[model samples]
Target: MKTNESEYDRLLHDIYETIDNPCAWKDFCSHLRESVGAASVHLFGFDRQRDLFSWSDGFGLANAEPLERIRPLYRDDVRLSWLRAFPAGKWLHCGVELDCADDDDAGGTTGFALYPVADGHRCVALCKLVDHQRLTVILACSAQADDAPLAPAARALLERLTPHLSRAVRLYARRFALNADALAARKRAPAMLVSAQGEVLHSNEPAQQLLRATSLVRVRNRRLALTAPHHARLLEDIAVSEARLRSRANGAQAAAARFRALRIVGEKGEAARDASPDGASSASGQHEVLYAFYNVVVTPDDASAAELRAYAALTFYHPRSAPPVDEKVLAAAFDLSPAECRIALLLAEGLALKEIAAQVGVQHDTVRKQLQSIFQKTATRRQPELLRLLLNLPGGSAGAAPDAG
Candidate 1:
């Protein structure tokens, strides 16, 4: 009795400490398995709004059959009546056994019947709201039955663990909100955490606003879909190009070279930083708007056997509210020299020929010569036409980044 009591106490402490760190689902699930003596453990969450389901820390399920195959029957298990009506801090136990029964009249096996006691892979569970209080949690485990009732010990441990689990989720939400708020302070950009198939698991306010106002791209079933077929094709090509660039020999070295050559997609501002194999791909406004695609991996709690997990975190930057563009973008996009890029920006700012020369610290004739070169390179015949074109360039606002010349 003494040893059992002490072991249970220690397990409770470990579960608490484990979830205190960021992204602690795996560690918490491990501690849960050892504490309950269960064969498997799973943490699930249901988003009522999107009606989406996600699970993590599924122990002993790595080699198990894919959930999708079983999903038709068990995806939304009617047997989880208690789960649908779950309490905040209380642990729910569900176990039932289907056994062959003899037909009373025929004296032969008639049908299978569930035994009174709860029996299943998923034996214990907990739930809470996470991700800015928008997502719900259902943490559960599958512990095999012993002759003696283990419920008391399980309850004791969970009582100690539930509060911490809820707190950890709240902490993650807070961290996400803080990061997004910080970015919004500087720019009117927003981000999303999307599944590989494009399901949006989480989205910041800025992203929501951008989507509501924009028609070129829309969120359907919580996934990003492009309105223009051509735009979608272009984006697909960019993703393919970047992915191929990342797969070559000396891929790391080659990626840097290609990034410099393409002058597109990097963590300049609010880039997808999920750190998965799908890495973040982003595009800010050229003259329209910018979007970021972050790849996320969705590993189940019992990831011992399951596969196929990637997500696309979508981000949006409206051209009307975009941050200033760097000069490098101008030089690359318009194929202008450094001097020409600076002069182009100055011309957009309503500076006269002499004024631009003065600001650029060049002689009048030198500035005039540069202007002609800029005119030819930019395909504009005169200053006013050139100004209109430059002013309409992406991130052409007063708040744009310093002249990238």
Candidate 2:
């Protein structure tokens, strides 16, 4: 099969366009499906940690029901398990089948059948592990019979598209998380967006004031500089995060290397606190300012105009002034029940299970069960991770969560 250079270029452009304009995803899938002469093409992600499908879009799907139907069957599909063994950027063919088993409680029996084979149609799928916990996939089903094999040229085209598609998906997810983190930290915290090279791209009023009040951070030659002697550690943290972001190497070791918090003193050897919105030191008169770094999304506009292609968010917030975790927002964000939300709030306040149970007037056993449910709902494994997740939520006050601005 002859490959059209212009056609491939357009497809590549469409893939990146989906990062900013998600609705264009359908167009990307449609173009790819037509290019390969396939019946349908799907772009979807799965969160293995949550055991749930994350986001999905497809072209040439007859109706939306199959999308919903596939969700329940995904956990039981052997193809997904088999696809995991293959490396990213490699496409493999598989037949769709569902295996079901009933335990003794439901009359013990193991059953297997070719489910919804649709005349023995076959699919070519490529899986990309976006991170340790998430998997993104592209699947194309042949319009022809199962016996009809995919063309070599089609396979080659897909292989060529793999890296670009993976990058776009990663950027899409990063943009979403960045928006959320920015909204959460922009109001009550002094936050700035800085490039990998330490150039300040953007800084809120609080951040500007904080920079003015203390010598821990300074603008030297139009770049953010950590002047405090102890801040070398923070600078190294930023470098490691940027390296991981640029290299797209988010393995367990890199994730562990991500530094969430550091403490820095003022140049005068006094403790520095984050400046308030009105350009004054925090009213709490906190001793030290806590610095936290996060990998944030680079906007489509900034991606072109900036000297450095990658960036990180630097935030400072006074622990004393940190607002209480909002139960309503917790409920809305994680689908937690009112009871579970209250328990989560208590947990965020650094309460033990027994303390939470006693305070909430619930049995310890009940609190333990609710805590487990909270863990599942939040997709967090431990209490500390849950606390960090709650603290990073996009609302500082009670009632509704703020919009990601």
For residue 395, what is the lDDT in candidate 2? 54
Off by over 4 Å in 1: 1-9, 16-20, 62-75, 79-82, 96-133, 144-149, 174-405
> TM-score for every candidate vs. truth?
0.34, 0.37
Q: How far does residue 167 in candidate 2 sit from its true spot (Å)?
A: 26
lDDT of 1 by residue, 1-405 (tens): 222667656645655564345345565566567776656666555444444443334556433422432332223344432233334555444432212143222223222111112433333333343432345655655544443333566656666667766776554433322232333333335566554344566776557666654455567876666545533543454444334433433443333233111112222343322334765433332233345443333333232323424334445555433333347657866788888888877776668989988888989899889889988887889988877676455432323332212
Q: For residue 90, give model 2's deviation from the true position in Å.
A: 28
The Cα local distance difference test for each model comes to 0.50, 0.60
**What shift in Å separates residue 218 of candidate 1 from its native position after superposition?**
11
Worst 10 residues of 1 by lDDT: 108-117
Evaluate model 2: give its TM-score: 0.37
lDDT of 2: 0.60
- Model 1 scores a C-alpha lDDT of 0.50
On residues 224-340, what C-alpha lDDT tens digit does candidate 2 reach at each position?
787455356555655665455455564723463454665654333344444557644452334455455554443222222323244567776544445567676788788999899
